[model samples]
Target: MNQAPRQRMTAQARRQQLLTVAWQLVRQEGSAALTLGRVAEEAGVSKPVVYEHFTTRQGLLAALYKDFDSRQNALIDAAMAAAGDRLQDKAAVVASSYVNCVLTQGREIPDVLSSLDSTPELAAVKRQYQLDFIEKFRSWFAPFVAPSDIPLATMWGMLGAADAISNAVVAGDISQQEGMQELSALIITTIARCG
Candidate 1:
């Protein structure tokens, strides 16, 4: 579907294209350059058509945020596939994969995260994505604990670290490997001692 004709694209497919274009542009130029006119010109469609697909800039950015989240989720699922019995090991995989995805996507995740908390609209858009990811990560770390022993704040902390690591890496203040190692250590130790 990623390769399908722009004209023949299904609603889902067209949205996917919109997401694809948005990611490329945002990744290349950061979120400031994410404009409907720019996306329309790049996708070879009219501005109104772009608006039809994504009613507002935030709507489009929100959709791209979902796309990035899905990609992160898929990477986690793939990492856990061959993981050893240790839930920490699975988490190490998730950290590495998540870090890699965020680093490679440039500034999309960082931009979204930075914009989200301060801006009500973006915060509302990202709210569910944050929750879903936290639940998934919490479950990944669950086997490290007796189900009754796990603390809720641990989930929140780990997800916050994941976002921080992504932002640091995207800001180029840390290397990708550094981000992965720190995340792996932080999450594993947090689960080990607290869970």
Candidate 2:
């Protein structure tokens, strides 16, 4: 008996499909289950097909991080735009949006992100994303902050506080609402110190 040939997916479609499979596997079985072979099996594709999209495990992890980063930035941007002109409102909106994203990402994402950082390449990618976020925050908040008040270090600290708060939320150390409130207070206090 002969089997039917598989339908061919466009390059972009195939990449997206693999990424979805990878994320599902991570969510279902933790980050330890995210091998290329497992992803191919879960995705109903050949190992070579997965490899074609991501040359190595590190490449695959990097792609996932980039995808996550893009989605997160979009959410933050939308929230910030919809927020009031006041710095406190803007900060609360942004922090709430970010914490909401983390909460909705399923419990496995934080582990996957941590595991992905084991490699130097992946760690560098993570660091680069953090820097990009800091720059974006600096650009957005500059208008509301005093010129001499918000320096680069302060921007970096703000970003770190956001990440730490999100991590705490993910770790179940605090409720999402609490995390948002705490982060908002930090942001408001930081802004106040700027001028």
Candidate 3:
């Protein structure tokens, strides 16, 4: 009997496939399972393929982190755009959208954090993205608070609190609604206090 020929995927398609497989490993099996070999085996591709796309484990994590942040930032931008002129309304929408994203993404944030935390290059990348996010928050809150009043440290603190609350909701320690409500309140108050 003659076997059918397999369809070949393009390089970009294969890269995306590998990333998807890696993401699944991180989400379902934990970030510890996302070795190049495991990703290769699970993706049904050779180890060389993963190496070709991502020069190192750190490279793969960097790509994943960039993609994750890009997507999350896009969501936040959309939420803020649709939130109208009121800062409180914008804060509530932003908080809800952010926490809801964390709750719905199913371990993506933790997996990204775990996979990228140890690598200095990727860690720097993460930090830069965070700084950019904080800058955007600073711009939004500047009218309410002076540039000196809303320091980067304070913004980082608020973000840390939001993430902690979001993690609690994701882990079932708190309901999603409660988490959103609490986060919205926190964000609003934090903005108000920044003044």
In TM-score terms, which candidate is top? 2
Candidate 2 per-residue lDDT over residues 1-195, each given as its tens digit:
999997888999999999999989888888887889999999988999999999888888888888888898899998887888888888888789878887878576687678768988889988899899888877767776656547888888888788788888988999999999999899888877886
> What is the C-alpha local distance difference test score of candidate 1?
0.79
Q: Give one digit per residue, the lDDT tens place, for model 1 in 67-171.
A: 777888887798888888886677679888988888877767777666556568878878888787777776666777766555768777888898898789878
Best-matching candidate per lDDT: 2
Candidate 2: what lDDT?
0.85
- Output the better candidate (2/3) by TM-score: 2
**For residues 1-195, could you state the per-residue lDDT of candidate 3 as single tens digits?**
999999999998998898889888888878777788889999988999999999888888887877777788898888887877776787788788888878777777777776567878878888888888888877776777764568777899878887888889988899988988888888778878777
Ranking by lDDT: 2, 3, 1
Q: What C-alpha RMSD separates each model from the true structure?
A: 4.1, 2.3, 2.2
Per-residue error (Å), model 3, residue 150:
1.9
- Model 1 misplacement above 4 A: 1-7
Better of 1 and 3 by TM-score: 3
Pick by lDDT: 1 or 3, better one: 3
How does each model score on lDDT? 0.79, 0.85, 0.82
Q: Please identify which of the two predictions, 2 or 3, would achieve the higher lDDT against the true structure.
A: 2
Candidate 2 or 1, higher lDDT:
2
Superposition TM-score, candidate 3 onto the true structure: 0.89
TM-score order, best first, reads 2, 3, 1
